[model samples]
Target: MSFLFFTAVGLLAATLGSLVGLGGGIIIVPALIYLGPYFIGKEVSVATAVGTSLAVLIFTAFSSTWSFHKQRKVDFRSGWLYFLTCGPGAMLGSFLTQFVDATTFQLAFGIFMLIMALLLIFKGYLKPVNVRWAIQRTYTDDHGAVHTYGYGALPALAIGLVVGIISGLFGVGGGSLFVPAMMLLFRYPPHVATATSMFVIFLSSIMGTVTHVALGEVDVWMVLGLAPSALVGGWIGARIASSLSSGKLLWVLRITFFLVAVRMIWEGLG
Candidate 1:
């Protein structure tokens, strides 16, 4: 029954996460922290919840990345660039977790989520000045549609570094930040950003998961219970997202972030 319950939650989390390019950590981490107690009749520590969530993300991120790759929506060039910095950042973040207690981690996650929510809500009015750098390139999607975009390499590298660290620290896939940065800062289309984010997340999650496992933070049984469902859910969600308009996708992301923020804040306060 416990396995079934967590599997169901994983399914839902993966579906929503893939649709919005979040990689499902935001949903899975909180669900496990707040709801696991009810199912297990004991409190689950924040580190355990995060570690388990990262483990599950390994499967979901791969599933989502494969789905997007099939549609040729993923921008390999941009994704690789982000992955380079994200990998190191994730490693550092995982190590840093040794210093963070449950209360501190919970509060930090809540505050970070709240800040991200506000950023998403006011993204339109907070646009940075457009600047072109030497990394200009044109990408063609599976549909033969071409997108030309450019961004400062240094700025992108910095963003990737920060995002990777955050992902490792929070056991998230970092899509929430990566997608927005790609769209707002790099001028990538929403669909392209979402696809590329999944790839970047897949890379970051690999390193983060390994680090968490070494730290003995992951719940192996829970990961086994949730992995299969998360894979299926991610595939289904990516397909659905591919059919939706960019505007609709952004709305879904915005709402999810806001709701997650509220929940995290409430839990942190409690």
Candidate 2:
């Protein structure tokens, strides 16, 4: 029964995560932390929960990325660059987790989620600024629609470093930051940003998971229970995302972030 419940949660998390290129860690980590005791008949530590989520995310991200790749939505060059730059930070964050208590970490995660929610809500009202140092690139979507965009490589690397650290620390895939950064800062199209973010997430997650495993933080049984559902959910989510308009996708992302923010705050306060 616990396995079934976790599998269901994984399905839901993976669906939303893949749809938004978040790699499902936001949902997975919180769910494991809050619900694991009740469902699994034992208390699960925050670190263990986070590590398990990251392990499961490996499958979810891969599944989603594959779906996006099929549609020619992934920007491999940018994704690889972000992945490479993010590695060091992720390693550092994983080590730093030892110094953080569960309550403090939860509070910080809540604060971070709140900020992301606000950003998503106000994204449309924000004005765009031209970045003079941006590297230009062109991409053709599955439908042969060409998109030309520019972004500063330095800025992206800096953002990736931050995102990686947060991901390792919080057990999130960092898609919450990455997708928005690419769309708003790099001027990427929404779909392209999401797809590219997923690829980057996959690579970064692998690094984080390895660090967690070395720390003995991961729950292998939980990961096994969650992975299958996550894979299927990820594939389904990517398919749905391919059909959604950018506006609709952003709306979904905003609403989800708001809900997560509220939950995180409640948990943190408790």
- How many clashing pairs per prediction, in order? 0, 0
Model 2 lDDT vs. the true structure?
0.84
Candidate number with greatest lDDT:
2
lDDT of 2 by residue, 147-262 (tens): 77877778888988999999888888888889888877777888889899989888888898899999999989999999999999999889999996546766776777677777
Q: What TM-score does prediction 2 earn?
A: 0.93
lDDT of 1: 0.83
Clashing pairs in 2: none
Candidate topping TM-score: 2
Q: Write down the worst ten-residue block by lDDT for model 2.
A: 125-134
User: How much does candidate 1 score in TM-score?
Assistant: 0.91
TM-score per candidate, chains pooled = 0.91, 0.93
